[model samples]
Target: MEGVVVRRVIPSDNSCLFNAVGYVMEHNKDKAPELRQVIAAAVASDPTKYNEAFLGKRNEEYCSWIMDPEKWGGAIELSILSEYYGREIAAYDIQTTRCDLYGQEKKYNERVMLIYDGLHYDALAMTPVESAPEEFDQTIFPVDYKRSIGPAEELALNMAKDAHRKRSYTDTSNFTLRCGVCQIGVIGQKEAVEHAQATGHVNFQEYR
Candidate 1:
């Protein structure tokens, strides 16, 4: 793990799942809500592509629900991120110490990790090897790593176990944000994002 560090996005936003994966996939937290929309659209376009146990609702209904910015991404979003983006998603459930690998399971070369603390999911990505954390002026994604990197499935599991024991992943509802335009504050990152989706004017920078 020399020459590498795990990328992290905190605050327990409802977008942690997407934000975490996006940080690895796109290297930006802002694209998280947009990523949710993309996955929802993907699931809507192909109802048969996903497993029933994870669908949670009728295909169309679930698709619509997932598009809501307030909705938290879970197994469904993880699957979509893996398949649509063509990367393996190694999700570690801290409670069970079990790792669920999503993607083609054979063909996909790149991979990302999602930690499931039973009630919440958090993204964990290793920093690129060649670059020093403080040396980089701009963040890069998994695909941007020009050099080959080996899979660290066991490493991901260990990290999740440590995080779970440390209570690193908290329920996202505890975050609060105040809108810049409307000057209205909302509890939970979900509510703040939903408000932004509706008004398109809130500056969620005023985090509480």
Candidate 2:
């Protein structure tokens, strides 16, 4: 693998899965409704295939719940989206740090990468990404949940975390105020100024 890079950050709201997929595919936030519709429609159209056993709810009910902005998406939704888009969905499962590409025909070369960190799903893409890891290197990663992660992969994940921490969450400068008090994004300039106004610590940097 060349390297991993973040293309976008979907909000941490419950609608994150749909929003993340939409952001990755369309570079915007408007496709969630359409994606949800496709998932619900597909599920409703075939109850046997997407039954309560698989979905944990009646087809119609699951469809309804998934469409709600508050409901979270999972493997079932991911499959539906992959089929609807006719593109492979690449997922970086954060718990295992395993990158799995999901699709049937493998006819389309285009792919959408999503990162699932147990609680949240985010959009991300890797550099020099291949259809499979072995396509670039001979390493075969075991998917065993009980196994420990290797040093190199662990380092890569740590590096990704550190980089994300250093980078601004928002690309737009207007939304972020880099505080001179501390370089990290948690406290914006306005907050810094407010603190200064309240206490006399007046060092601030406009990040935008």
- Best candidate, lDDT: 1
Evaluated with TM-score, which candidate comes out highest? 1
Weakest ten-residue segment in model 1 by summed lDDT: 135-144
Misplaced by over 4 Å in model 1 are: 4-7, 49-54, 104-106, 127-151, 167-208
Give one digit per residue, the lDDT tens place, for model 1 in 49-167: 65455585777778777777656777767877877777877777776677887774445766666677655565565544634453341222232243223444545667777876876
Write one digit per residue (lDDT tens) for candidate 2, span 9-50: 578667788888876666655677778888899999998998
- Provide the global lDDT of candidate 1 against the true structure: 0.64
Q: How many collisions between residues are there in candidate 1?
A: 0
For model 1, what is the alpha-carbon lDDT of residue 36? 75
TM-score, structure 1 vs. true: 0.63
TM-score of each: 0.63, 0.58
Per-candidate local distance difference test? 0.64, 0.61
Q: Model 2: which ten-residue window has the lowest total lDDT?
A: 134-143
